[model samples]
Target: MAFELPPPLAELRTRVRAFVDDAVIPAEKAILEEDREKKRDTLNALRERTRAEGLFVPHLPKEHGGLGLGIMGMCALFREMGRSPVGAACFNCDAPDQGNMDLLLKAAAPAVRERWLAPLARGEITSGFAMTEPAPGAGADPSNLKTRATKVDGGWLIDGHKWYTTGGGDASFLIVMARTSDDPRTGATMFVVDRQADGVEHVRDVPVMSPPILQHREAELRFNSVRIGDDAVLGGVGEGFRLAQARLVPARLTHCMRWLGWADRALHMCREYVLTRESFGKTLAHHQMIQKKIADAVSGIHAGNLMTIHCASMLEQGLDKEARPYSSMAKNHVARLLCQILDDAIQMHGSLGYSEDMPFSLWYRFARSARIADGPDEVHDVVVARDFLRGALTTLV
Candidate 1:
């Protein structure tokens, strides 16, 4: 019955909108203009302003100097932030960092927190979560993990190769998944390896479509006899799988929520173009086909937003097990839908959307990877189907 946000949340959304329009949008233009060398500098300057506005780290707890907002509130803020691709990154709520921060807060030791989490929370240094590996490694299957952490005097020695490590190149610390027990029956365990540690090498930065990134630096990590203390274990031995899942659920939801705003912004751009651009004797908006496309774009965005909000609300209520199925559905659905919506918006823009002069083309490029990046749409679909069969589906449906 109550579909509208509460008064405080409504006010928060308005403020977020204003901040994004007045601040984030302008910064995006500057980012688009900057060369690869200058983008990081421009981004840092913009982030300083976001920090001053107290808009950074909305999901972090209050004790850690965050807004300490609930999931619904975070979803609202993230959607607004996602309106600009740089907004989430600027506010220190971007992926890898967002997920990394959540892990530290939830399960990391206080000593580990002192060494790494505090700096991360303050946005002083970057971090990465390395789970995916190349072929013959852990790609898409935790059970296929080939990375091994052999027991040795004082610490564990790590040896393996990883790719698509989203922020690995810039990360001061990496949460790595490796096999500690020899049975090969138990899933891989996770360890926190400092970036400067011996045998940890940054192969190279894999170029991606997103811009203004300090760590589009998804690199290949080679660990040959890399060492860390027994304290390096995150959570507990054999518990890495659980910890990884915990971090991923919220991470995927946040991604879906943020990208929904990006798609909304793209749709708005398409709508404005249609209303202004003339075709034959009339504006593009006058065409029935254009109207249908615009309608679908809006509908897709609404559906994605609804799914994200529902998941967020459930999470705030601590209904997480019930929420996981929805999170996967949302991540998979929204990621794919976002790509579709962006494609439609591009079609609506004609050649302009496909051109590098506009962010539309870049968004189209970035959108394609979303489905694959977060556990692929196929994986989420399987989870959803299994849940549906188990009769565990919830109000998020």
Candidate 2:
């Protein structure tokens, strides 16, 4: 264990755990049922329930209808809610939106916040963080960013290509990342563009391995001279990379936590099945190979959990530079750990796991993307090496 939770947080974890097990997990049936209308109804009801219990939007500040829990506090809530496929969304604390809200709270102007962030906080609208561009443009490395935001009279004219912009297909608005200059460090800027703005086009929703749920939907969008007013600027000009770090650093850690919970769910399912299913002369759980797999996964989860907690504490303390090494280490570790755990579960389940009739197949689809999303495991490893060489050694907790 890295550190002990305060008494209040410990108790809160218990309550939220109960809520997830007793309520949210049950709602996952709407997914298998394949009833969109029923799913929406169930989600709306659960949203109200989470709000009533003071668990909704746990990442946002108290004034924005969140718990003001800071980074460390929302961790417990996110882990528990992540048990179900639909869990975190019900509470309005899922990614892209969650990360977007974090940037908005810290950077958006008051009027801009009222017009955009306010409705988004209440879930009246959805937004996509459009930073990843197609190949030959920005993907893992922002230095390759090619989308240009040319300064025009009274505002900026944005022309770009973005793919895998999660939630873009149905989002009411988008936060776009565009290069403003040739200087690599201060070349980028972020702007809020309305979905209905002229010259903005949603090409299509890119099919992914996971189910076609709105949350997992990746999309392609084009800005053909789409114009945005000066008011839409988030943070400041030439501050895009800085502002993005503020969002991505914490976001990558939070993603680690939620996936940690989901991995635990997979392990639980594997354990239950192995104990009941006989192999050779005994149940599969008694097999030495099976025991070894379980042992490795349990230890890996613990290590990842502690790493996430340690990095989270650094963020809470405002040790931004100090947190980067640890954050990179945790994201890479957790992303790889998730895939191995899911693979082990699938191997243990044998034919049942490989089949679509089981949850492992779906879970694997989700876990497989962990390596690529946020930032690829390869990129994080590079970051770890570069930071260590730069003598950024204070963050090795």
Candidate 3:
């Protein structure tokens, strides 16, 4: 019932907020502009700053050079970092990599951890998850997997086509999901393939609505008879769905937390604007419709944060299976709210919001992608509906 963060966590949140506002936000132009060399220089400097602040990999364990904050703590801190697009990545806790680190911590064998997870947590390398495929394959639907990893001499022969493989184009390692059997749910398995491995092709980065993000770049990859030993299999054979769900449960919520920050910051900008910007007769903040927009934004953000925290609490209590529907519900609601908040903020700012003078338009594209990222809005809606339709009784509260 308590809503306050612990003293330590509160301090952590304050530090992160300052860091993002001061260091991360200012570096956006340099890190996200057309000059590739400038982007690399800015990011490298930012990474060192993060480490010096003892805030690198906040969600990871202490042993992995993180602060050891679990899911709920991560939610609090990530929201602060999420205010800016590159905030999370500044501490090496962005999507794909952050989620991949969590999965490797729980499901990866020690040897695998020693080899890949260690450096990843240290921010020495990046990773990718290859589950989505081209049309007629698994995408927004993992059950229709077409990529296969067949048993072969000394290893498994992986062959498939994957797109939207986030970060795979230049990642140091990739956790690929491939069909290993006939059953839809239990038939898949996850394998770790090094980027330099033979037969692993990095076609090109896919063009998307958002501009080239240094931290998040989607790739199209082909695994043409790529072979790897048994050591590459993560969790276990026939456990791809289980492992993926495990990673996604928290991942979906973390993404919500980070994006919530983005939307919240946008709303803050609107608040600042309305206070001084005059309308027909008075300041925009004095207008009823503007007040309504502000009110709705605060309420929606509060509701979304609560839902996300509740889902995270469930996961912290080892309620993985029971938490899926809740995660989906949170993702569905939060993702939609993110769009609404960003859109409303834009409306309040009017033409300025549409202009490049503010970050609102750029963020809108990314927020729009949230609906389809983990699973589409429709997909999560079905998940919640299916869970309830089967006669469940408990509520999140």
Best by TM-score: 3
Q: Tens digit of lDDT per residue, candidate 1, span 1-397? A: 2468779888878877888898778877676566356346677787787778777787898888788888778887888888987788778888898888888877777788789988888788989888888888777677778888888888789999988998888799999999877555555678888988989999987766765354555788899899888888888777777887788888888998889988888888887899999999999999999999888888878888888888878788898788888999889878987888888877888787788777777877766878888688888888899998889875434
Q: Stretches of candidate 3 above 4 Å error?
A: 34-38, 393-396
Decoy 2 TM-score against native: 0.96
- TM-score of every candidate: 0.94, 0.96, 0.97
Q: What lDDT, from 0 to 1, does candidate 1 have? A: 0.82
Ranking by lDDT: 3, 2, 1
Model 1 lDDT-worst window of ten: 208-217
What's the CA error at residue 145 for candidate 1, in Å? 0.9
What total of clashing residue pairs does each candidate reach? 0, 0, 0
lDDT of 2 by residue, 220-331 (tens): 9999999889988888898899988888999999888888888888889988998999988899999999999999999999998888888988888899878987888999
Residue 319's lDDT within candidate 1 is 84
Q: Which ranges in model 2 have alpha carbons more than 4 Å from their true place? A: 32-39, 394-396
Clashes (candidate 1): 0
Error of model 1, residue 24, in angstroms: 1.3
* TM-score, predicted candidate 1 vs. hidden true structure: 0.94
